[model samples]
Target: YCEKFCVFVVSMDRSFLPETPVPSSLSRRIGGGHWDKPYNRGSLMLRAEISTVGDSQEVSSIHSGQSRLTTVGDRLMDSKCKCGAKEQLILCKSRLEHLVGDDRKRRRCAVNRGKLAAAGQAALRILSDDLLAAVTEAEAEMKACAARIIQEELVAGQLRESEIGIVERGCALGALRDKVASLRAIEKASQEKLRRHVDRREAERGSVLEQLHSRLAVCNELRATLTAIKSRLSLMRHRVRSRQDSLEVARSDMEVYRKVLDEVPAIMVDLANGERETLQRREELERRAMALSEEMKEIDTQIASVTNSRAQEVGGRKRCLEREGKELDQLAQRLDAMQEYVGDCQQRRMSGSSRL
Candidate 1:
């Protein structure tokens, strides 16, 4: 820590002012020299106005004729100077206290010397009392300075904690923002998928409706064709009934023919037997006729021989024999007529059987 001490002077006119100027060399000599050394008025007032600022390693801000102090305190040093100005001291801690104390002691000694030259032992007693009072005041000021430093340190620590909390809150806010963005993206994708599903369902519904319409048309056409087939079936049933009636009439005629066919075999057997008998009878008659013709020829030869030998001798006998020959011719003619009649009967029998 660094400390600052300032000392100011009040003139007899009761206003802050610079003290009577002193040479830099004389001020330095007075500050470093022993108290027993003789001093001048400018040096005494200059020492009373002197102040210092001190750090750990170096000290500065000591002016010979001016001060860096912007404010003057009501606290005065227990000393008076030949220039008729009073001294005001504002003390700090550590080395600043020492510097101010030494300057005060010197000012007091100079004041004491002048008063001692006039008032003797009584003036020395008053100076001693003022020095003790100044020391007590210095100690109280040091305690106040220590308390102020501690308060400043506490304020600085609170500020650092607040800054750290702010940084952590900022990081948490950033993470929350990123999580919200991802959720929004997922919601958008879900909505898009739902839209696509709706479109596909619409397409399928349209195709199903078209198929239903086509199937309905085909059903109507089949209904019309079924009506036409039913009408044709009714007409075919009528034609079949008429044809069935014709078939019944033909069945009756076939039964009668079947009975006649059963009798025809026996009738054919009888006709074959009759034709065999006729053929045998006709063959017998032809053999008999052939014999008769041969006999007639022989008789003709005999009659011819007789007529040639007895032609004049038997004329009447020839007349009788010619009459017998004419009668034989008549019998042969009658046999020819009977043979034709038998042939005609045979022809009539064959025609009758053929007709059957």
Candidate 2:
């Protein structure tokens, strides 16, 4: 039967024939070429459902604006169907339309059911989070009150009834009740016993007076003992005072020790600070010494460079002095030759004049 139902559902027209009028619910997502839109979740679900519940073959017949009762009627109805084949087919078509229509209602019902469940859960959560503790407490308090009331009722019920019995309990209660004759007998016996007890008490009282007199003598002996104890107590008090004074002196000494202990940390701190400062100064001195050594190296390099430059200048000056000294000797020999040539020229001129 379920297979038939599935086949029937799967055989319905689905392909949304070009001629099929658009419903308002589906128009937003499924549109003509001019109005395209993405399918929403609902539209997609509807499409999937339609595709599953419909066939391309049946779409033509369903959309053909006419349906024959003979087409699907014989296949859909049970063997017990008494209706005519044509009538059955019409009924089938009507049922199909009704089922199709129910799809819309089903969709709405699903949405409503989901909404109701979500709302119910939200309300339940709120109640659990905000009110459950208080409600449970109230219920517990009510239960305790009920239990207390029941317990009180049980305890109250345990008390025997105060109703006096005449013949209800017959002989048992009758015998147990105080009777006038028995009460009179009991009274007479009680008076006799009380008289005997009174005479004995009076005798005991006389003996108690004699004991009291003996106690008075003992009390006089205790009085003397108390005086001696008082003297001892005074000595003890003096010793306590002395001990207290010693304790005060010890406390003063402890205070001095405490002061010394308190100063120890400050002294240690000062020593530590001095050590740290000394270390810092030592590091600074080392750094300065290193810097001075580097400067001394630079000074030594500069001095070496200056000495080399001066040596080059001295060598150049020595070469220049040797060249100047050779030039001076050549000039002196030339002067002597020129002076001898002039003397020869003068002697030649004088001998010529004497010959003329």
Candidate 3:
């Protein structure tokens, strides 16, 4: 009977004891229990009764225990553990363990994901910075290339303008050179013509001088002949006067004889014949003087013609000389113009070369 009573006590103690603590590794399996039970066993409840005596010590102990239990129940409610059976507890400690493990794993995963996202963002930021730097460098290079091209183009344009100017100046110089050449040719021809004219004029002047000298000699000879003729004329006149005086004396003698010879007629006729012969000789001398005067007039006309011809020749030579001088002046001016043009061309060429 005692053993049986002890067994009953042990059984009751076992029912009141807390459930065994589940291992952390095995908590998930226990929380997910699939054990089968009958419908009536799930609904069954076991009850225990205790006897109380009035004024008993055990009763006081029991009342004190009951009060303590009630106080513990109130405290459990406040702590949010209102369920009475530890084995059938609403707040599953085994499930809580499993949930803590699950939460730790989730938190670790979230942390890893956040770290990965941060690393990716950092990598993207670095790539973007590098790209921006490369783009800026390329833009700067492009700008530099454009600036260099513009400078080259401006220089080329200036060179082209200089070349064009040089070409135009060259053309002008060429034209001037041609003009100078033509003028030189003209001047040369004019000089040759002038020389020929001078030569001819000099020859003509020499011929005129010779003719004048010859005419002068002829005039001197004529003058000498005229002087001799005048001397002979004077001598003839004196001889005629002496003969007249003799004739007068003879006539006076003859008159005395005629008175004596009034009886002789032959002597008187001979004296009359002699007087007629003397008169005829005087008339012939006057005729010779008139013929000499006509000859002198003809000589004067020939001298006047020679003088007029010499004057005309001299005037023609003077006009020719003036024309030649003018041609020489024109040639000099043309040469000067050509020289200036050449100088201009040289300056332009030098300027163009420097620019190039």
Predicted structure with the largest TM-score when compared to the true one:
3
Q: Which 10-residue span in candidate 1 carries the lowest summed lDDT?
A: 1-10
- Give the CA lDDT, 0 to 100, for residue 34 in model 1: 22
Q: Count clashes in each candidate, considering only residues at least 3 apart in sequence or on different chains.
A: 0, 0, 0
Question: What CA root-mean-square deviation does each model show from the true structure?
Answer: 79.0, 62.5, 39.4
Candidate 2 residue lDDT tens string, 56-96: 33433655755444324334443455545445355545656
lDDT of each: 0.45, 0.50, 0.48
**What TM-score does prediction 1 earn?**
0.26
TM per candidate comes to 0.26, 0.27, 0.30
Error of 2 at 95 (Å): 99
> How much lDDT does candidate 1 score?
0.45
- Tens digits of per-residue lDDT, candidate 1, 1-356, equal 11122332222111343344434433331111222223444354354334222221122333322343422311122234332223123233233446456657866864564343334334334444644454455455446445644654564465456446545644654565465456456545645654575466456546645654554454455456446646776766766576666646645644644554554556456545655654565566556546645755665576566446545434544464566457546655654554564455445433432331
Say which candidate scores most in lDDT: 2
Superposed model 3: Cα runs more than 4 Å off: 1-135, 236-356
Clashes in predicted model 3 = 0
lDDT tens digits, residue span 1-356, model 3: 22333333343342453343322332221111311222121111111111112112322333465543434322333354434433322223333334445556655654564454455445545555654665575566557656755765675576577558656755765676676567567656755765685577567556655755665575577568557757787667766575677757755755654454452344335434544543454455446445645754664575466557645754665575566557556655655654565455445434432332
